[model samples]
Target: MDKIKVLSIFGTRPEAIKMAPVVRAMQQDDRFLPITVVTGQHREMLDQVLKIFKIVPEYDLNVMGKGQTLSTITNKVIIGLDTILENEQPNLVLVHGDTTTTFAAALSAFYHQIAIGHVEAGLRTWNKYSPFPEEMNRQMVDDLTDFYFAPTSQSAENLRKENHASEKITVTGNTAIDALKMTVQDDYQNPELNEIFDKGNKVVLVTMHRRENQGEPMQRVFRAVRKVIDQHEGVEVVFPVHLNPKIQEMAQKELGNDSRIHLIKPLDVIDFHNAIARSYFVMTDSGGVQEEAPALNKPVLVLRDTTERPEGITAGTLKLVGTEPQDVTNAMIELLENQSIYKKMASAKNPYGDGDASLKILDEIAKSIKR
Candidate 1:
């Protein structure tokens, strides 16, 4: 049997984490040749995941820059991929989730009449602008996709609801669960991590860098977290603050100088994954962590009022305790004091996947291009 060439493209940290497992699986399997491409939409953070995965992308668009708009990113990726895809025409183009890169690469491939496999597909909030471009990106990508690797039955249903073809969709679990295998190392070490554990305090891994939670909402959440940590003597917060100036300013002003709260710079994929593994629980406004935390058996208190990932909450692995200070504080308190509720959240089955999502995705790709 001849080897099938697969080009896997992604830009952000979450996309890389989920896609890494699929790429690694392909690299090991003699049946396929994997080509990885990083769009550099999220330069430093994206590179961190690639390094952790030991993946050197065959092409890098390096599209990140100051004041880059959605139009610019979409256009740049389309242009960059035009050349790459023309030269390295693969049997299949695999993209992960909803990102500018995911949509743009799929567009380029479709223009060239190449088949596309969407990993972590069928995720939807339905509201186009709720996630601000991500929702649209995934939807557009799905329209172009010949194969869909839906993470959950719910996600697969979402695709069906949108009138996507049933024959192309595969309900393969999320690949992020598979990524945990490589990232959560036994001998991971960091000075800040040590300082966190040294205080005999339970660490709450915090990450809130979303554009939606930027101004007042973010401040309110930070204030609530500070109050909660202050009230709990044996609790500490380790927040890897995002590089966004607004986030940095707010975090430094509100959470800085607090003994229990440690506001550090943005973490690389390895550091962030290891930190999540060590934490007692997680609080975040990000999408990926909501899915990732369940596998680590950690409770995630979503900072947003709503989430596209309702499956986690439905499965008892997550709680949608929105951005309201009172609600946030109450949720945190319950998790700390109520061991039964905490364990229930932690020990619930991971609805995302049992791993092996990448293999299922590959199988679908093989089926799509076969005959």
Candidate 2:
């Protein structure tokens, strides 16, 4: 029996984090040959995740540049994958979540007439521009995808409403949970974090980098966080600031110069997972963190007004505080001051997955290709 050749492509940190488990699973399974490609859309951050996962890609497009637009990323990925697809000709191409890389890779696979499997598919804010390119990217990729690996039943239902074939969609939970299983360690050490722990301060890990929350929204949320920290005596914030210039400026302006708020460089996957594991709770606008934090048994205060991952909210692990200062302050106070509320949110079951999504995804792929 000939081995099924599977090509997995991703460029950004979020996509890389979610897809790593699936790629690693393919590497261990004898039934398939896995080919890895990185578009390098997010360069440094993407490299950080790849190193943490120990994923050495067979190809790197190096597509990142100063002031690159979405159109540029899409075109670069499509053109870069063109020759590779023509040469390797994998049986299927797997893309994760929504990014320019996800859409462009799916587009490239479609151009080559290759089957495409989308991981973390069917997520919808339906508003299209709510999350900027991501919401649209996932929607369009789903149109081109042959297999839809929906993380939750809600996601699968979204696909169904959009007229996607039910049989082609698999609710394999989230691979982010699988990643969390590999990343968080009992003996994980970080000097900065150690200093915070030594002070007996409760840490709140934060990651806010959504296009929608850029200027005013980000500033509002930052102020709310600062207010909460000021009111509480033994609480600290560890924010791994995004590299975007506008964001950097806003973060420094709103949250900087505060001893309690540690504005640090972006973290690698291992450091991030360990940080989450050590934190009291998380507050973020990141989609991956919504799923990952819950699995770590931490309550999450979603900084966005809307979320595609509603499973966490329904499961009581996540609370949508949006970017309103009052709401954000209230949510933070409840988590900090109300022990019962904190326990209820912290102890809620994680709806993402049980950390076997990669195995289930591989099994489904094998079964599909064999048939």
Cα lDDT of candidate 1 equals 0.87
Please list the residue runs of candidate 2 whose C-alpha ends up more than 4 Å from where it truly belongs after superposition. Answer: none
Listed per model in order, the count of residue pairs whose N, CA or C atoms clash below 3 Å is: 0, 0
Model 2 residue 157 CA deviation (Å) reads 1.4
How far is 369's C-alpha from truth in model 2 (Å)? Answer: 1.7
What candidate 1 gets wrong by more than 4 Å, as runs, is: none
**For residues 1-371, what per-residue lDDT tens digits would candidate 2 score against the true structure?**
88999999999999899999999999999999999999999999999888878999999999999999999999999999999999999999999999999999999999999999999999988788878889999999999999989999999999999999999999999999999889888888889778876687889999999988999999999999999999998999999999999999999998999999999999889988988888999999999999999999999999987899988999999999999999999999999999999999999999998999999899889988742
Worst 10 residues of 1 by lDDT: 362-371
Summarize candidate 1's per-residue lDDT along 291-328 as a digit string, tens digits.
88999899999988777898998989888887888998
Candidate 2 Cα lDDT to native: 0.93
Q: What TM-score, computed on C-alpha atoms, does each candidate reach?
A: 0.96, 0.98
RMSD list, candidates in order: 1.4, 1.1
